[model samples]
Target: MQALKHFRIDFVITAAVLVVAFLYDSWAGVGLTAILIVVEIVFSFDNAAVNAKYLDRLNHFWQTMFLTVGVIVAVFGMRLVFPFVIVCLSGSISPWSALNLALEKGDPHTPGTYGYILTEAHPAIAAFGGMFLLLLFLDFMFDEDREISWLTWIEKPLKKLGKLDVLSVIIAGIFLLVASETLVHETHVHTAVQMRSIVLFSGLLGIILYLAVSGLSTMMEEREAAKDHEFEEADAHSSTGQKVLLAGKAAFSMFIFLEVLDATFSFDGVIGAFAITPDPIIIMLGLGVGAMYVRSMTIFLVRNGTLAEYRFLENGAHWAIGALAVMLVISIRYDLGEFVIGGVGIAFILAAWASSILANKRDAVAEGATDSTEQGANV
Candidate 1:
């Protein structure tokens, strides 16, 4: 009963999604929706941990905002509207036209079919999302203070290279250019030159989006730090109002981060859904349900402090993200199936879990040895 209260909205949303799933009145439709949802939520286990890092830092009011308001954004903004926007920009259609095109869907090869349009726009989608995710992985790799190394041989060298300024951007650009060229040669597109232009511009937009969001957060953190310094000298403790105010600021920034991160994670799910079915409503319902559960999982991890207990869990998620990034770029030319994508993500996460267990056991053993050594010396 108590647990139900926490997941009440998620329950409602899930019911709504299943109803939407069944709206088409076809077994194939319903099944595809279910499959996409499972794919999204399973592959996004890492996303939950990532969101918890930021979501847990905020106050109850802000957390509630994420639970409520964030869902609307995830469902409507990313799942429904975002794809439309993608097709609109790439296909050169108005919003109304895009909606009509999506609704009046035909065969996959048929012009203006939702699947066709979305598939056509894959290069741009892949470029934008790949750049965003690549930056994310690069930043994590370059993080000097990161202690754990899932791939130490590669990570150690990257960490060293991370010392160079804007190296991530440079590497991402090279990949983007290479990927766009690959798409020109490999993918069935309208034109090589046009695809290159769209991809290059979209990839740049993605890089800008990531830098802008992260820069804003860094700026806010700096201001918050300065405020804390003043508080330290001015008073023994801050007032409730001041604390709430700080929390609000932090939450606002985190809210932005959460939304963008959610979008980045959804990139693969969005494209991968088309492989199952291209009906926008079906994709939205299925992926939206998955998004709801992912958000719920994020909140669960935050409240349960799951990341604290499983230290390397977050590292595994990020590594999975890096792999996903690579897959997105590679998929531009190659038809890397959803099975491959989801399988790789799960493998990284499980490997991380196993590594965490070993680390904890080793830590316990070391602590025991140290305690015995001290006791023997005392005796």
Candidate 2:
């Protein structure tokens, strides 16, 4: 009963979203959104599990931010807008027309449109993916305690700044400004510019809201902790309220961060899909739906302790992230099919899961043998 109550909001919201989607079902709009949701869900299975570890730590306010603000940005920013950004950067087609062509013809770079003007796999896109991959590779190699020579001068200072809530806001705002300006500049058509601005602004808004909520949640947790001076335990403290708030913030932060990751992952899929079909609406529907399902699956994985039970899963996901990052960089220079990236990621995760299951069985068998030996000796 208690668990059901706790999940009531999520259930209701999901239902509501589905209902709206159903009611609005045009062959192009709502119907497409539904299918896309499934696709996003499948692609994001590992992502949700990774996010769950963090979600379980956030507070109520932060949790709300995850569902509301986080979803808005992720669904729009990456799933809907990213394809057009690719088109703009390619320089042959207007963003709006590119999107339209994608929807109508089911291809972003069809034979007739300006999409024909430039080659597939623009250089800039690859650079973006490469930069992201480089970060992941370095993070994996160095671990948290490792230091980078290039960042030595600023690393400590940045670490300190990260601890400051206010600084996060400033940093997010700056990033938003840059992304927005870049999107606007890349877009050739007036309508495309407007649409790009809206999408970019929404993303910026999400980042700002996330930082603000996280800061407030942190403050509340600190205040509550101070109130319970003697409260200490190895597993959990007596500050239930504080824990909830903290958990919510952590969950929200994780959700937002994961959404960013999903966006990064989707770059190749969304852009490459344009080659098959140009309609922005269809592309958006397919990708958006897929993204949502992945988010849900991630939450389910976290709640179920899937990753903890299968340590190899984390390694698989991180590896996928690294690979996708590299793929993005390659996308900038040459054409690699979206199917290849998605397929590689799925295969890696499946293999990791299998390995973990086998390892668990082996460990269980060993433990049983030890227990039997101990019992025989005692008898």
Candidate 3:
């Protein structure tokens, strides 16, 4: 009963969101979205485990920021912005025109059916996928923390660069800008001028989001401090509140960071999804819902301690991340469709998770047998 009460809010929120989505659409779109949610949730099991390690360090206000702002961006921002940038770089239309199209029709998936829409999809998409894939490969191969990761040498030297908070935000902005512009020119889809403007605008968006999260965090801290001073000595509180506040903030930042990570993962995912259906609405619906489920599941894992108990869960998630990164890179250079990406990525995690479960069972059985033998010998 007590546990239920603690999680009642979470349950209610989830239920409400589902109800609303269901009410909004009942046919192909909603069904597709549901499937996406499930797929995303399953594939992202490891992500949640990894996320908890950071979320456990944040404060509450940030936690709230994570659930709200983080969710919105994860569901809409990336899904919408990425494809638009692709359009802009292709020079199919101006940035303003692309935005108008998406708003008027809600994310056109294919160039042909986009109402004779001026689109720059062709080579830019290929280039975007390629760059995304390259990044994925480097991340998977060089990421230095997967139970003895590959790039510890660089991590320490990089740590000396100072204020990772600021640096990470800057890097994210730069990536968005470069990704938008580079894809446009390399794909030969758009003019340099158009691509440049798109990159600049997208970079600005990144900067604004970073500032919003950070500024909100600072304000929250100030408010918390004032609250602390108001209490008398006998009625004083322990630092648990402060700790939770910190954990929430860290969690929020980590949540956004993970979303960026998720976006990187989605580069291939979205590309592959198009193979299934060219409808932008369906694609967004599917991928958006999937991201949502993954995000929720991540929160569940942190709260449940499943990862900590399993021990091998983190390894599995990192392995999944690494694999997805590689897969994205490969897709960039080749045409490894959705089935391959989804199948291979999900299979790796499932195999790893199943292996961990079996190992745990074996260990438990061995311990039980040993204890029984000891009891008999003592007897």
lDDT-wise, the better of 1 and 2 is 1
Greater TM-score among 1 and 3 belongs to 1
**Model 3 spans with C-alpha error above 4 angstroms:** 1-26, 42-46, 59-64, 99-253, 373-379
Regions more than 4 Å wrong, model 2: 1-39, 60-64, 84-107, 110-122, 144-256
Candidate 2 C-alpha lDDT tens digits along 219-311: 655665555455544336544433433543334445555565555556566655455444455556566656655555555565566777886
Q: Candidate 1 lDDT, tens digit per residue, 91-195?
A: 787888888888875565776676787888787777788889889888988987778777788888888887886998899989888877766543454667776
Q: Could you tell me which 10 consecutive residues in candidate 3 have the lowest summed lDDT?
A: 115-124
User: lDDT tens string, model 3, 223-341?
Assistant: 65566455623343454443433543334445555565556555555545544444555556666666665655656666676775665555556555555544443333255655566
Winner by lDDT = 1
- State TM-scores per candidate: 0.89, 0.62, 0.60
Off by over 4 Å in 1: 1-8, 23-29, 186-189, 232-246, 377-379
lDDT of 1 at 105: 53
Q: Give the top-scoring candidate (TM-score).
A: 1
Going through the candidates in the order shown, the clash numbers are: 0, 36, 17
> How much is the lDDT of residue 93 in candidate 3?
65
Candidate 3, residue 210: Cα displacement in angstroms equals 15
